[model samples]
Target: MPEKIDYLKKIRELTQEYFQISLDDIPIPETELVNIEPDRADGLLVGSKEALNYQYLVQGDITPFLNKAPEGYFLIGFWGHGFNSYGFYYSRVEPNSRIFFRLPYGGAYMNNKREAIRIKNFLINFFEFKNKLKTATTFNVVESMGEGFHEIKYKDQTVKFKGSVYRQRNPEKHFQKILKSLKVPTKRHQHIIKLPSWAGKKYEDMTPKEQEEYQEHLRRKFTWEPGDLKKVGHEPLTEDEKKLVESIKKQEEDVNKE
Candidate 1:
């Protein structure tokens, strides 16, 4: 626990130095854990009559249903802990994926206090960064500060068909539309708990181009791991990503000036 606390402390220091956001604008969670699970408690997710973003700024660390974290990020906020550029409060303080890679290793703790010499580790792994830098760089957040959706696009790379059949991974809801039209079947699917009146429409209702675009723009809505895309080669930077990174850097410089 002591080492975990130290690593968390270190995370805060680096975030403050590079995130370039005003600390006052982003308050920290009082502790590493939320007062309670937001979903389990009423009003935790909906909050008061304040703006959704304002509520998150005031109490996001405890809410999960309304969370808009960077794609592929675990963001310790679930446990009320903050790391990298994230504050425990759930606000996207300095939304940079690079902040996640900044941790010395990863996870809640490093080592256990007991054991002769080996001292077994927790988190099911040693709680270290094996390839956090590489993985973190493969994705970026759409915004550093937003009370809205935390949109994320996965970095894509072109791969030649080498005649080796590749197993498929789960695709996003929009992409599933394409598969549905193609008559492909899958046990897994994007589950929408709530359905609006328009939900009555089926995949046949979508135009071909719309379906294709949805599939083409597919992205990850969950965490990333080395095994997930280990074989995918490097992707050339998309024009949008290049621009976003530049804008982030500019903001960093501006914050440094202050």
Candidate 2:
């Protein structure tokens, strides 16, 4: 119980800092009983390594909190399927429950296109994944999608998708297959950071200066360079090169005139 609370504190703090939140103006989570031996819900099993302690409570447990959340504050919920292929991946934060921003793993697409884009922008700014995020949004970032995904009523409007979403096709069947044994950053969390703890100290906690490293890391992870092979690679000529080309063209013109 204490562990889950502490974990939530760390996650919230990190997320706040990640988003450059000046104040504690965010969703307050409500949790469920999970420490009970042999938890059957498996709600807690779908998050990233850092969220292991709270996964048991993530699934259905957030409803009470959402129901009570004040308007204007977005509700965020976390829950997942199977043993966690990526253990976690990007989740669509929809505004279906006027209560809070539901971050549930099994959540459907957002219906309000404009509002969805607005919320996504805020989240992208908050998560700092704006650079690495590869969403399906075309005209609006919310509508565009990628491969391996399904189309459903995001909120009010109907959405069609050609490729299925990445999360819908996580290959790893069990956590063991996808889990990466990680080392907790320092002695601070030695006691709390146990086996299932993966992201004890990752990009989530990186300070602004430290975030540069993460930014660079993301740039490399999704590295791409502009290319136009069909169009002959055009290089701007220097003044001297430009003069030489012009002179050649002028000489050709002179010959043709003759």
Candidate 3:
């Protein structure tokens, strides 16, 4: 048990560094090293044994994890062979998903309009440079396993095609370098929970109606409902959102001047 805890701690640290996010923002989830393949003995009646190879993140839907995110925040995830590969994910107190982008490598499902645009531009430039540089790097040619098209859609960016596949024995190191280069410090605004002024009275002394209202308020405060998107692509920002973004930009500019 202690070993598993330590192992998860390391994984969280890696995720934070690779995703360019803070450790406090990451959520802790029940995890286990799952068996990926079962070793088979030649001409044997049963397989030799199960090999706990893959790092299993979660099974089925990743929505439950994303739903916990706060408004104006988005969740990022890496998509691998299966759904169990998305380790623990979390979001702020509110959530939104206006624009979504996924490469053969996965990306964030973002809500903030300004942030989505910035990341989209970054991804476009990154992949274009990578595609050009790939030919210079050593290539490992292998027989075709199967043919399938990779498609990505978000705003002005869209890609759909079937082509030669690239495989690497250990791609994690290379990916780590790319993420490190793009790493930028971000601050997540914190919320302080406080009871209403009226709630200062003792619970036992409160009126029946007041008690009922207090209970309702508590339920509303604690309950988290999943956010729904009318459409799963890019959407224009409202005037209010635009103003908020302008304010943020001004703050950043001020910080740079210091």
Candidate that scores best on TM-score: 2
User: Each prediction's Cα lDDT score?
Assistant: 0.29, 0.32, 0.33
Query: Runs in model 3 with CA error above 4 Å?
Result: 1-5, 27-79, 82-258
Q: Could you give candidate 3's per-residue lDDT for residues 47-121 as a string of tens digits?
A: 101112211123222233233322333323333334222222221221122112222322133233433343334
For model 2, residues 1-258, the per-residue Cα lDDT tens digits are 453443344444544443343224542333331221115343222232223333223334344333442322321233334543111122322233221122322334433333334333444343332222123231111211222322323223334344322223232221112112211112244456343222233544557665555444333433233321121235553454344344545565689799
How many pairs of residues collide in model 1?
1
lDDT of 1 at 138: 27
Q: Better model by TM-score, 2 or 3? A: 2
Q: Using lDDT as the measure, name the better of candidate 2 and candidate 3.
A: 3
TM-score of 2: 0.22
Q: Write the per-residue lDDT of candidate 1 for residues 42-112, one digit (tens) a residue.
A: 22211112222223322333233234433322332212233323222222223333222111122244321
Q: TM-score for every candidate vs. truth?
A: 0.17, 0.22, 0.18
Provide backbone clash counts, one per model. Answer: 1, 25, 6
Global CA lDDT computed for model 1: 0.29
Worst 10 residues of 3 by lDDT: 42-51
lDDT, residue 105, candidate 2: 24
